[model samples]
Every structure is written in C-alpha cells, then in structure tokens.
Target: MTNRFFNFNRAAPDARSDVSFTRRLVSDCVVTVGVLALFGLIAWILPAIDAPVGPEGIPSTVSTDPSNLPYYALRSVFRMAIALFISLIFTFVYGLAAARSRRLGKILIPLLDILQSVPILGFLSATVTIWLALFPGSMMGVEAASIFAIFTSQAWNMTFAFYRSLQSEPKELDEAVRNLRLSHWQRFWVLDVPNSMIPLLWNMMMSVGGGWFFLTASEMISVNNRTYALPGIGSYVEAAAAEQQPDKIGWAILTMVIVVVAIDILVWKPLTAWAEKFRITQSESTEPKRSAVLTLIRQSHIDDLLARILRPLGQFLDWITRPLGRTGSKWGAKPSRRRAGDIVFAAIIGILVIAGTAELMISIARTTGLAELGTAFGLGSITFLRVALLTALCSIVWVPVGAIIGMNPKVSRLIQPLVQVLASFPANFIFPFVVMVFVLWNISINWGSILLMALGTQWYILFNVIAGASAIPDDLVEMTRNFHITGWMKWKTLILPAVFGSWVTGGITAAGGAWNASIVSEIVSYGHHTLVAKGLGSYIAEATAHAEGMKTIIGVTVMAIFVVAVNYLFWNPLERLAARRFNIA
Candidate 1:
C-alpha cells in the first residue's frame, strides 16, 4: 500500500507537467495573436481616419467630434504612441554615442542643447512647407506633419534621461562589464539600455505630458495664411480656443487631468515599481528606499513567474552582451587600433556631411543668384538676433526664479507640474487670447512673438534647476544647515552652484526651443489678420506656405545652416564651460 501510494504521487509530477505546458502554450499563443491582430487593425485603419464627421453630417477634424470624445481620446493616444516610438529611437542612439566617447559627447551635448531649445513653432515653420509639398493634396501630408511635431515634444527629455544615466553609471560597474568580455551590441542591449530604463521611463512620462501641451499647435499648422488642420484633440481644443468657448476649454482641462491621473496610477506607477524591484541593493551603506509597486510585485504570483522566465533570459543576455563586456575588447590588443579606426571613420563622415551641405547650398545659390539666398540668410540673421536677445532676457528673469523654486522641495513639487502644464500648453491655445489682448493693449507684434518663443522653452531652465537643487547631496545640505547658512549668501554659496549644471543644460535646451518658437512667435494668425515678424521664422513660414519648389527648398536649407551655426558659436562653448566646471562624473 505504501509503495503504491508513493508511485501514485510520483506519477502525478510527469502527468501534471504536460498539462501545464499545454496551458502555457495556449496562453502564449492567445497573447501573441491578440497583440498582433490589434496592431494590424490599427495600421490598416490609421491612414483612413482623417476628417471624421459628426451626426449632423458636417466633416469634423480628423473624423472626431466633441460628442465622440472616446474617438478623440483614442487619436491622441495614437499620436502619443508615435511620439514615444521616435523618442525611444533617438534616445537610445544618442545615449549610446554619448557613453562611448568624450569627444562625441561634447559634440552631441551641444547639438541636443540647440535642438531642445528651439520651439515647436520654429520646427513647424521650417518643416511644414516641405511636408505639404512632399505629400501635396493628401491627408497623408497632414498626418506626417503631425507626427513630426509630436517628435519634437517627446524626444529631448528621453535623450536627456539616457545621456545623464549613462554618464552617471558607476565606475566599478563599468569595470565589471569590461571583465565580462561583452560585444558592443551585447553591452548596449544588456547593460546600458537596462540601466537607462528608470530615468528613461520617468522622462517618457514627462514627454507624454509635453506632447499634450504642444499637440494643438502641431495639429493646427498655419503658414502665411495657408492652414492645414489635422484631426486630433489638439484641433478640438484649438477650435474651441478660436471660438472662445470657455465650457469646452474647461471640459478639455478636466479630461486632461483625468488622463494624467489614470496614466500615473495604471501605467507609470506599475512599470516604475517593477523596475525598482530589479534594482538590488549593491551597497549596505545606501539608505533604504521603498517602492509601492515593488512591494506589490514581490507578493504577487506574476513576480514568481517572471523570475522563472528571467533565469534563462538573463543567461542569454549575458552571452549576447559578452562582446561589450569590459574584458571582451582586451582579448587582443587591437582595441586601441579599432577605436582609432572609428575616430577616423567618424571624422570622414563629418567632413562628407559638411561638404555635401555646402556644395548643395552653393549650387542652389549659383543657379538662383547668391543675392536672393543672401537676402533670406540676412533676414534669418536678424531673426536669430531677436531670438538671442529674447532668450537672454527670459533666461535672466526665469533662472533666478527657477533657482528659488528648485531649492525648496515642497515648492518645486507644486510648481513643477504647473510649469509642465504651462510649458505644454499649446501656442495656439493662447494665441487667440493673446492676439485680442495685444490688439486692445497696443502691444507690439515683436513683443507678442517674443512671448510665444519664450513660453515654450522656459520650462527647460525651471526643470533643470529643480533637478539640480533636488540632487544636492544630503551631506552637503546637512553641513549647510549645521553652519547656519541662510539668505542670499546661501543661494550664492550653495544653491546656485549646486544647480548650475542643470541651469546650463536647461539654458542650452531652452535657447534651442526659443529659436524654434520664434518661427511661430514671429508669425501670428487671427480671424483674418496675419502678422509676420521680419525674421528667420517668418522667412521659413512664408517659404513653407508658398510650396513653390525653389522657395521652400532654399528656405529649409538656409534655416538649417543658420540654426547649426548658431549652436556651434553660442551654445557649444557654454556647454563646454558647464561640463568643465560642474560634471561630477
């Protein structure tokens, strides 16, 4: 009887295992097919989703109406997803490049600074004409432009997260990876990318919010009286703004708040928690930290399942990343030679790009008179000057205020979300109101344009300062407190220096954003009246609207040149200065 009972129990193990395998296989198939089918359907229908109509038979923007709020919300979700995709690509590439070499880092950091500083308006001003021309007389062009606009709102923060995380990775950890002999691809996919996730996720959340702020301006593009409105929540709010419908605005705001709360609760909180759990305590000296999501995951069956799966996945990753691991390159003494080859290749590529652009511009100018190109370039320079002055002034005003807000954690938390909302608030959302206010108050168009340009990029400084202030070492804070440091002296001696790096980073990015904003800032459209400031943005905006082949091409070319040059001359030097003075790494 005992033998029979033992045999029966032992037999159950093999029998039960087969059933579990079948169940898992079915579950995996269902999940895979479901995901694939859903995505496939979305892809099939996306192109046809334009200019939806209401029950009244009037074609609404992008086939969405206020009455059909769910559809509008879905459109916004789709747009944000696209932005996230682009951001992830750029962030990963930029982050890896920055991590590899200090020289590349130097060039990239400044480049990103300029890119981030330019406003959404500026980006639209430069690109819209080309997009319209590229996809003329079709809804496709409008959709493409919308995607590009979303890219601007999302990419920078992710890049910042990746770059900063890579830069701040512990030295010993890097050494350990080197000892592992991982390949470059392996190292990046396994070590660098995983390490970047926490910060990247946080930045992505912020980017989604930022995209919301700019979505309206992105969807509603007007250049030189030519308007191309795409269907999205941005357009909905924009239309409401035009009509001054306070009720619709209120509804939009309420909806936005709910969406933000839902995202925080359902998505970001859960993902952040899961990532935190994987972050093992590598040091006993480190203070204890609690993650609610981690706690939940720890007690769940899902965690057990994931742990089981990860054992093999981890081994696979280690094998793949072996080439990039610290000792991997040292198998032979040719790494230095290989690195030299990389440098040479990069230099050659850089030269080729410069030569190509120069040749292309010179050819265009030769065919169409250098005088015409020069005239546009000259006007662009004037616009550039205006942008610089405005950026400087705004920086002066906001940097101090940002410092104050940064120093106080409680104040920073309160102001941070508000700043984000204001920063993301679409330029068009306020353009109508600003126009009316300006007309009545007799404000000059220049000032109005400056305000628009300043509005979009100011958050860079505010957020950077806050980040820096918040990151001030706890020991340092205690020291200051013990020493009775207070007042302006405290700010000058402690807070200012502490946040200086963030300020520079933010300033560089803000400066770029301001330049972009200038395009929109320089050009304004009301019911019938359109004001064009005599600068680079207007120059591009006008060229973009004409869609007459040469004007558009020339305008884009000249604008890129000026933008690149401005960064090289101004932002690059400042970035080097900041890094030298403040880089803890």
Candidate 2:
C-alpha cells in the first residue's frame, strides 16, 4: 500500500497537471491579457459615461449630474488605487517597526493610535500648509494634500492590523521561525506579511468605507470656503450636495455601494480565500510550500530575474545590519548600552525641539509678536480639555460593552464588522443632519461638535476592550468558572483584570483619537451659518482658512504636546500596571 502511494515514477500526473504547460501558460496569459484589456476598456469608457451631453455636445468636465456614472466610477477607481498604494507602504513601515523592536514598538504603536484619532479635516488643514510650502508655485500641492488626506483615512487601520498580528503571532509559529534561523527580512516577507493578510484585507475593506467618510474633505478642497475641487467621486458628491440635487447624490451613493460590493467580491474575497490556505498548522501539513500564488511566483522567471538584481542589495543591507548585531546579547543586552542608545535618541529629539523652537521664535519675530504664541497655546488648552473629557467619557461608555462582547465569541463574531463599519463611517457625512437637529432642538453647536469627534474616538476603546476580553487566558476563565464566579463579582475579580491590558491599549488609542478628533470637534457647520466653538480645532480651522502660519503651527505644536504629555502621565503608568498584572507567565 505504501509502495503504491509512493510510486511517483510510474504514477500519472495529477488531473490539473495533465494539461500541457503550453496550454496552461496560454490560458494564464489570456486571463492576464483579458484582465488588462478590461481594465483599459474601463479606464477609457469611465470618463465618457458621465460626459454631459449639453446643447452642443459632451461637456469638457463633469457637471452636477450623478447620472454621469462613468466620471464618478473613474474617480472612484483612481482614488481607491491611490489610497491602496499609500496604505500598503504605511503598513509595511509601521508593521516592520512595531515587530522589530519592543521599545520602539511601544512608542510607535501608541503614536499610531494618536495618528488615527486625528480628524480627516484636521489632517487636511494641517498638511495643506506643508504641501503648499513644499511645492510652492505648483498645482501638485493640493493634489499631494489630497493624497495625504486619503492616506490618513486608510493607513491607520492597516497598520493596526499588521502590528497586532506581529505582536500576537502564535508561540509555535515563533518557535518555528527561531528553529529555521530565518533572517528578519525573510521572517517578515515569508511569515509576518502572509499571516497579517487576512486581518489586513478586512481592514482594507473597512478603509474603503472609511475613505468615503473623508471623501468630501479629500476631494472638495475647502478651507474657509477657499474651495478647489478634484475631478473625483468626492468632488462630484460635494457638487451634488451643494446644488441640493438628490438625483446626483443618490447616484453618487449608489456608485459608492457598487464600488464597495465590487471590492468585496473581487479583491477581499479572493485574498481571504488565499489567506485560509496559508493558515495550515504544523500538525496539518508537512509541506514547505505556502500559498499557490507564492509558490508560482517563487518558480517564475520574473522572480528569478528580481532575485538576481536584489542579491547585491540584500548583501549590502546585511553588511550594514551586521555591525548592529554585535552590540550585545540577543535578549539580555547591557543596561548601560541600551541607556546609551536611549540617550542618543533623546538627544536627537531634544535637538529637533530646540531647533524648531528657535525657528518658531525667529518666525514670530518676523511675522508677529511673541504674545501670539501664548494666545494660540491658551486656545489650544481649551481643545485639549475637550479632547480629554470626551475621551474619558467615551471609554466609560464603550469599554464595558466591548469587554462583554469580547468575552462572548458569538457576540463578537456577529458585531465586530458592524463596529468596524460604524467606527469608519465618516462623522462629517452626518454633520449636516447633526447641525440641523441641534438647531431645531436649540442645542449648542459645541455639544454637536463633541459628538462628531467622539464618533471616531469611541470605537478605539471598544475594539481594544473586545480584543482584551477575547485575549484573557482560557485557564484563568476556566478557573473562575470552576469556582462558580458570576455577575459583577466575576467581572471585578476576573474579567476586568484579565482584560486590563487591552483596556489600557484601547484607552491610549481612544485618547489619542479624541485629541485629533477635537480639531474637527471644535468647528461646527449649519449650512450657510457656521458655528466656531471655543476650542483648538476651531482655532486651527480659522488659521488654516486664512493661511495663518504662526497660529496653525503653534496650534499643532500645542496639540502634540498635550497628546504626548497625557500619554506619558496617564497611559504609560497604566500600561506598566497592566503588563505587571497581566504578564502571560
């Protein structure tokens, strides 16, 4: 029976292998050619679909007509492509940094949370000045800013997914990597990236919708109504909204839904299917090969060509990293040496701060009085207050619910995607309705703004809580159950403490988001009537509109300081506590 199974020499080729290589190659080539041809056809036809057939002929540009499906479709495709490329690069960098070193990861991971918390509008306003400065006397400035805006919406979720995967890689998997003696690059390319794809794909799907939430800001360039519209879906949507054209708006919404579904079917589903095949455990399969794509790529002539080109580059990188490898032991390096590196990093940071401060001083002297900085700082403090208060409130509301849901795998399964959808939904889309409701109810615009900011930040806590709750050691849970622990007592004694680490992670992320969200929270919109609340976001928005460099820079600086200080003061201590209390010994 063994001989029969092992008779590879006499056995016929597998069913799929029966096809001649030439035929297989031709089929694959045809598929590839067909896909490219379809892409080209779509690209060519997309613009024409919405071409406005006026009295004379087709209009040069899209008008306020959602029936111009081609134009919006083209814009959607371009924007999606641009966003994906930017997100992929960000994920690679963030994921690599987080996985490479524990200390660096600690800072980078929390920083990611802070970055994600930042409102799309705030990001737009903050980056516009820099891009404009960089490409002075160019149309590319706004374009760059637009790309950056999309990046802000997409990068965080992907980064988070990659970081989480890196951090929580299975112990058995880790052992295999060590036993294999795989290089860092090999480990990342072969193991980490592949494992992260499932989560990353889901997150990318979520980002598509998240990207829409910020599309208005991303496409319709408006800083204090100094509007510049991109020839994109967002710009089209904004035009429709401005004209109160429900038909156009409806069309835009439908386009978005179609795009979302198309992505799910074509990209996400296929990638997820591929991910499943790669999830084989040690006991499940003895094969060294990974996924079909990876296997094919490995054997491809293109891969061979790339390997030949990259071999030298790989050697150079190894040579550079080789020196660093000798600095200390693998795990237990000298404290003094580690301290030296820390000091060097701190010194570099201090130098940058001092240099920046000096530059700011000179700029202040040239442009305005020193008093302006003080005024900006004071205004920014109000924004910080709002952010901190709102974040605390968000934690209170969402953390417990997240914990409960996280503990129940069934509930988590049902609601995780829903939570992600809610979290990613642009608060700006609802801003119009919120403004209207508040006006009708005679509620303050400040309260309305607060809610908008909270919308993005609140979900961070929930996600963290859920993750934390789910991560609680099964042994601990079983012990608790064995002892008949239940109700509030169960939560107090077991659940909270067990999931405390996750809570800290979530809180940190939420707080960071709140601070960023405040930039949007402090500014309110009610049609033609604009309400500027007493906060930093309002200040920054005002500064950005007028292109007030001093105030904007000062406001961003103040905001960063407040965020960093709060994290250091509150979150760091809590993180230490959680680690100490919940270390997986």
Candidate 3:
C-alpha cells in the first residue's frame, strides 16, 4: 500500500512544477533585459565622468526642457550611488573601529559628531582646490568632489546607527559566538553585521534623503570666480529657480518624484524584504515586508543559474573563513599587544592634528587676528542654541507620530512611499518661497532660521524613530497585551526603553543636520531682500562669499568645537545609557 501510494504521488507529476517552470521562463527574459540595460547605461555614463576638462573646466549645461530630466536624474542617481558605496566603506571601517575599541570610541564618536555638523558648503569649498589639483584636466576631479560632499552628508548617520547596533548586539548572539569561540573577524561577519543589518538598512534609506537635502549645494560648484552647475536634477532645479520658471520647477518636481519612486521600488523595498531574515525577534512578524521585484528575481531561472555559477566562490569564502572561526580559547590579541597598537594609532593621529593645527595657526596669523576668534565663537554659540532648540522641537513633534505609524505595518507600508517622496524632495528648492512668506509675516530672520533648518533636519528624527518603533519585538507586544498595558504606563515600561537607543541615534543626527542646514538656512534671499541670521552659518557663508579664508576657517573650527563639546556632554552620555538598556535579551 505504501509503494502504491508512492507510485501514485510520483505519477501525479506535481502541478507546481509546471507553474514554476513557466514563471522561471518569464522571469529569465525579464531579468536578462534588465541586467543588460543597467550595464549599458553604466558603460555610457563612465565617459561623462572621466571627460577631459578644457580651459573652461568640466562641461556643464543646464537645460530648461523637461525632456532632459531623465538624463539629469540618471546623473544625480549615479553620484548618489557612488557616495553611498563610499559611505558604506567608511561606516564599516570607522564604526567598527569605534565599536570594537573603547579608547578609539571616545575619540571617533565625538569626531563623527563634529564631521556631521560641518557645513557641506564649507567642506566642499575648502577641499575643491585639492581635488582640482589631483585631477587637473579631467571631470573626474569635479565628480570626486561632488561625490565626496554627498558622502559627508550620508556617512555619519549610517556609522552612528552601526555603532549603536553593535553596542545593542543581543546577548543571545554574544553567547553563541562565545560558545563557538569565534575569532573577531568571524564574529564581525557572522554576528555583528547581521545584527546591525536592519537598522543599517533603515539608516541607509534616511541617508539617501540626507544626500538629496544637500544635492543642490554639492552639484553647483563655484571656484576662482567661476560657477559650474553640473548636469543633475539638483542643477536642473537650481537653473529653474534662477530663471523664475515655475513651470520648469513643476517639471523638476515630477521628474524627482519618478526618480524617488524608482529607487523605492528597485532598491529599498527589495532590501527591506530580504533583511527580514536577519531580524532579531524570536517571534516572526506574520506580515513580513514583501517585494514584488525580489519575488520576480527569486522566480527567475537566471537568478538560480547565477547562484549555481557562484556557488563555488561562496564555498571558497566559507572555507577560508572557517580558519578564522574557532580552535580553542586562543584568539584575539593580548592586552599588551593591543595597548601597543593603540599607542601607534594615537601617535599617528596626534601627528596629523599637530600638522593641521600648525598650518591653521600660521594661516590665521597671516590673515586675521585674535578678535576674529571671539567673533566666530560668539556666532557658533548662537547657532548652537538654534540647533539645540530645533532638535528638541522636532523630537517632541515626530517621536510619538513615528512610533504610532511604525507599530502598524499596514500603515507604514501605505505611508512609506509618500514619506520617501517628501523626504527625497530637496527643501532647498522651496527656500525662496518660504523666505517670501516669512518676509510677508514680518518675522525675525534670526529666530526664523530655526524653522528653515527644521525643513531638512526633522526628517532624520522621524525616519530613525519609525525604524526603532517598527523593530519592537512581537513577543513584547504580546506581553503588553497580556498585562493589559496601555497609556503612559505602557510607554514608560515597554515603548520608551525599547526605542531610546534609536531615539538617541535620531537625535544626534538631527542635531548635527540642523547645524549643517544652517549654512543654507541662516541666510536667505528673495528678489531684492537678503536676510541674514546672526549665526555661525552666516559667518561661514559671508566669509566664503568674500573669499575670506581665515574667517571661514575660524567659523568652521568654532562650529566643530561646539559639535564635539555638545556630543561629549549630551549625546554620548545618552547613547551609553541607551546601550545599557537596549539589549533585548
């Protein structure tokens, strides 16, 4: 009877096989075209990046026609893609170093705060000359500067998210790694990265928005009294605004929407779906993230074929990693050896700092004096106050809203694309209109700068908090239900502690971003009216405008000091507290 049953089952010729074969055939054709087109587009754009510069510098023409937007969008996307890759590398190296070593963490975490607060414009202006010297006659120099500027805007948030995630590494995983006696490298690959993946992906998405926030500033380059507006959606929007062409601005908005939608579909959604497997929750989400594109790729015979082709390479990696996994208790460096390495690292860093300080002092002594130092610090204090207040206001407004939205998966899915479009739209494009309204209201530009900075800064808080709230474990939710927990009691016990780490991540980035946004926000121009706020941002901008190198350096240095001080006193302490509370296990 059992033999007959086996024979019957085998004879049925499973219907699922027919459907699978059909789906595979269809997906194979689709994936083939997609891959070809992607590579072809990349091949076409490489020349544009490396094009030789003439006496006029890299060729950049901004066209008003809507038809050209597709090309503009592609160029902008390419720059963003390169920046994101660079940022990921920076995150891994810098964030991992800080997370693994307490001594390095003290230095790097504060340094990261300062870097994120430094204005994009100031960094670009200061470094553009060096980049130009490196690739004197190629567009690649301009391209490199632009990409690096975007990297500055994107990298800090991801690095912070990663560092925090590592600190919050679930105790369960730590025990498992210890049980297996994994090497540092092995633990990094297998445990640390997997644990950080969800938060990192969420931060990566937010970082893309951060990149767009500075797109205009990065794409439009000014050097030696000559302005070069690169061919990108950012420059396109800038041109439209310059010409007072509201119609063109409308078209740019439409193009931006399309580009944002494509990114959400092609990139973030698929990755979000795939990362679900790495989720730390013991109880799986019934309504896990789903991606149509990933599903299609999974159905494709082409994907399977590629996997089969790469199987040997994957196995080779595993084979090599095995030696780095476990033998006994004899792994990692000795205390003396580690201390020796730290001393060498500190020596190298100290040398760099001394050299930079000597050069800065010499330059300032040659140009300005002690009076400018006081002026710069005073301006920095004003800006610091604005950033602090604005960050607090944004937190109050967005934290609960983000938490509510994130707790409901259906709501998050529905609202995610809308938020993406809103976040991806550069608020700088609408600055003139906002300024005009403020002018009409007889508002104080000094204080009103807070509102403008909030345009770009608030989204960081919202995005991070949503990720934190969404990550709350299903078992925790069940526990809350079982206890009939609600209202402030639920929040005090379950919600706040769970999301505190993410909130800190958001708060730090938001505060840093507020400082960065001040460069564009603290000074505004509308027709015949130019309003300037009394802040470090305006100090830097005015200095840059007049090509006052010493003043610019002083203003930037003061801003950096403010950032480092604030982080050391406030954000770093909060992060440590959150880390202590973050472990789910």
* CA lDDT, every model vs. true structure: 0.62, 0.63, 0.81
| lDDT by residue (tens digit), candidate 3, 471-573 | 8888898899999999999888887787788889999998988889998899877546688999999888878767777787798888888988888899888
For model 3, the run of ten residues with the poorest summed lDDT:
1-10
Model 1, runs deviating above 4 Å: 1-65, 101-145, 168-173, 176-206, 221-229, 240-254, 257-315, 324-328, 331-347, 366-368, 397-409
Ranking by lDDT: 3, 2, 1
Model 2 stretches with alpha carbons more than 4 Å out: 1-62, 69-74, 98-142, 156-176, 189-210, 223-226, 244-345, 403-413, 467-486, 489-499, 583-585
lDDT of 2 by residue, 1-585 (tens): 112211212123243356568755654565467568869966785554334333542122236655666665666566666877889988998788876786678568657755765556667765677876776555456666777888787787667667766665666777777777656655655567766654465556556655666677677766643665666766776665555565666666667666655554445434533444344232322222123333232222333344566666766664666544332226646899888888887788679779978997898877867887788778777777777778779877887898777666566546654665565445565555566677788878666677777776676667666655654555666678899999999988987886676666656656665666666567755436466688777877778778676677666666776777787788778867865665432
Which regions of candidate 3 deviate over 4 angstroms?
A: 1-19, 59-61, 183-185, 301-363, 526-529
Q: Model 1's lDDT to the true fold?
A: 0.62
Candidate ranking (TM-score, best to worst): 3, 1, 2
User: Model 1 has how many clashing residue pairs?
Assistant: 32
- Which is superior by lDDT, 1 or 2? 2
Clashing pairs in 3: none
**Cα lDDT of model 1 by residue, 251-301, tens digit:** 665566655555554455455434432232332212223334433333333
Q: Please give the distance, in angstroms, between residue 99's alpha carbon in candidate 2 and its true position after superposition.
A: 5.6
Q: RMSD of each candidate? A: 8.9, 7.9, 5.6
RMSD of 2: 7.9
